[model samples]
Target: MQWSIITIGKPGHPWVKDALDLYWKRLRHYARFDHVVIKEGPLDKVEQQIQAVCGKDPCIVLDERGRSLRSVEMANWIEREEVSGRKRVCLVIGGADGHSPGFRDKAQVCWSLSHLTLQHDIALIVLAEQIYRAYTIMRGEPYHRE
Candidate 1:
């Protein structure tokens, strides 16, 4: 399955970029994956930017208001989604100010990283790493286990 993350805003922090890149490279071995940065703008503009890049496909938006899942549960959820034969799975991350209500309404599923707030850049890195972890767990790799 092809998986991609389309976020609203460029990753400016050098450390966040580096960390995201590191996990992204590691994930490539497991699936077809890509990380895209949408130029920062107004909420509607940014949502439009993400929508344009995402195209028509199944997408799970990442938002604090979304459902929270354990790592194992997330791994299984991804596996199920891929098995369902979806062409693409787009993970959307909002800008620094967070997602607009309209954008949230459009998502097929909304996911939460944590209850605590996270910076947009840091959230990108965290999301990337969690995806990598989920794949590893699905493959029965030692990376994740209950």
Candidate 2:
């Protein structure tokens, strides 16, 4: 299945792009990967932009209030999605104010990286690495050591 990370606003820190590039390259070896940025704006407009881009793919919206999963559990969840015939899946990182009520309600999964709110650029980087980690776990690679 194709994996996409849809985020609101671009990475502000210069090195954040390079940091994500490393994970993106590693992740591409395991699954198709795509990154889409929704221009930052009013909550409703951003929600619309994210929704239009997400289309029919099951979305995992990142929020502080969401469910937390271990790295291995995330891998299993992704595996199930593929076996269940999902063609694409997106992990969405919303803007500073977070997603609208409608967007939050419709998301198939609401994921939390941490209890503390993270800087947007840092959140993107962490999300990318987690995706890569999940893939490695799926393959039983040495990259993920218990």
Candidate 3:
């Protein structure tokens, strides 16, 4: 299955961009990956932009109030999606004010990286790394150590 990470706004921080590049490169070996950025804007506009890209794929929103999963659990979840015949999975990371009520309600999965709120750029970076780690774990690689 293909994976798409759709985020609002671009990563302005050098560190965030660097980390994204690193992990994205690592994740490339495992599955098809797509990174999409919607121009920063109001919640409704951003949600529309995200939805346009999502098409029929299951959308997973990243929000502080969402369910928290361990790294291994995330891997299993992705694996299950593939087994269940999902062709693509879109992970949406909203802007500064978080997701709109409509977006949250329609998302197939709402995943939280942590209880603490994170800057958008940092959240993107962390998401990239976790995705890479998850793939490594699934492949029985030594990259992830319990």
Top lDDT hit: 3
lDDT by residue (tens digit), candidate 3, 12-39: 8887878888888888888899889889
lDDT of 1 by residue, 1-146 (tens): 88888877788878887897799789989889877888887888888878887789877889888999999998999899889987788998888878888889988999999887787888788888898999999999998857
Model 2: residue 68 alpha-carbon error in angstroms:
0.3
- lDDT accuracy of residue 47 in candidate 3: 88
Candidate 1 TM-score to native = 0.94
lDDT of 2 at 76: 94
Runs in model 3 deviating more than 4 A are none
- How many steric clashes between backbone atoms does each model show? 0, 0, 0
Candidate 3 positional error at 132, Å = 0.9
The CA root-mean-square deviation of candidate 2, after full C-alpha superposition on the true structure, stands at: 1.0
Off by over 4 Å in 1: none
Off by over 4 Å in 2: none
| lDDT agreement with native, every candidate | 0.85, 0.87, 0.88
How close to the true structure is residue 12 of candidate 3, measured as C-alpha lDDT? 87
